[model samples]
Target: MSSTNRASSDDEFIVVREILSRLGDKWSVRVIHEAAGEPIRFTDLKRKIERSTPISSRVLTRTLKQLERDGLVTRRVYPVVPPRVEYRLTELGQQFLHHAQEIMGWTMEHQTAFETARREFEAQTTEQ
Candidate 1:
């Protein structure tokens, strides 16, 4: 397996890694962003998040459920002829999003430098 697939052995930031993993998760961030402002139904969320359609419904469902369990998202179900389920970010979730978005801003700001370094490093490796 590639290094990316290997489990991290460094314990220095294991907790940080675990926490960061959730935000970096393929669906979690998108789902959170999509459900940020107001309560949204599953189908609407699925459509609002770009490229999320490729993520299996099962995976998305599980992600939403886990987020709910973590108190990051509130799930509401309406008792109607056809049950309506919606999700919205909890207060805790909003706080988390604030920080996460801040970090994302930092990354975006540095993305060009990061990409430049990556390209330089790759060129050196390929030449060697």
Candidate 2:
């Protein structure tokens, strides 16, 4: 293959890997899932996410910023006595969520198989 084509392929691979790294992050997925539907205040999002997994305020803030930078989430500040900031998913984010949900469904369907595979691997390793 041509060097130019190889360079382009390498660049595309890097971009895709970066995107996957961002979306595959635990905090990023949690934030995206919680931020779906209506716009939610930062505090509320934190509270909801914490119910499932504990996360620090700083980490949440950083994750939201990253998601915003990736164009997956939008942050809006409301003028008030105490400033309020809310987050909502963009159209692209919704599309991503749809795909994620499908993958999640597949995982659930094969959860038992996954568990069995893990058990078999562990048993074999222990016998070594």
Candidate 3:
């Protein structure tokens, strides 16, 4: 292949990897899922996510910021006495969530097969 072609391929690979790395994060996925229907307050989101996975306030804040930077989530602050902040998914985020859900469904459907493959692989490795 030409050097230019190789360089293009490498750049594409890097971009895809970066995107996957961000979206594949557990906290990111959970946050996206939680922010699906309506805008959610920070504390409420934290509480809901913590019910399944424990996350610190700092980590959650960082994740939200990253998501916002990536244009996947939006943060809105209400001008009230106590101040209010809410997070919601953007259109792009919704599209991503739809694809992620499909991938999740596929994984669930093949979970048993995955487990069996892992067990076989482990057995073979241990035998050697």
Candidate 3: misplaced stretches above 4 Å?
Answer: none
Q: Is candidate 1 or candidate 3 better by lDDT?
A: 3
Please give the ranking of all candidate structures by TM-score, highest first, separated by commas. 3, 2, 1
Q: What are the candidates' C-alpha RMSDs?
A: 6.7, 1.8, 1.7
Residues 10-103, model 3: lDDT tens digits: 9999977876887678788888898898999999999999897899999999999988988889999999989999999999899888988988
Top candidate when judged by TM-score against the true structure: 3
lDDT: which is higher, 2 or 3? 3
Local distance difference test scores for all models: 0.83, 0.90, 0.91
Tens digit of per-residue lDDT, candidate 1, span 20-88? 787888777778877899789988887777453566678879999878877889999999978999999
Alpha-carbon shift of residue 44 in model 1 (angstroms): 1.5
Q: State the lDDT of candidate 2 residue by residue for 14-55, as single tens digits.
A: 978876886578888778888999999999999999997899
Number of clashing residue pairs, candidate 2? 0
Model 1: which residue pairs collide?
none
Against the true structure, candidate 2 reaches a TM-score of 0.87
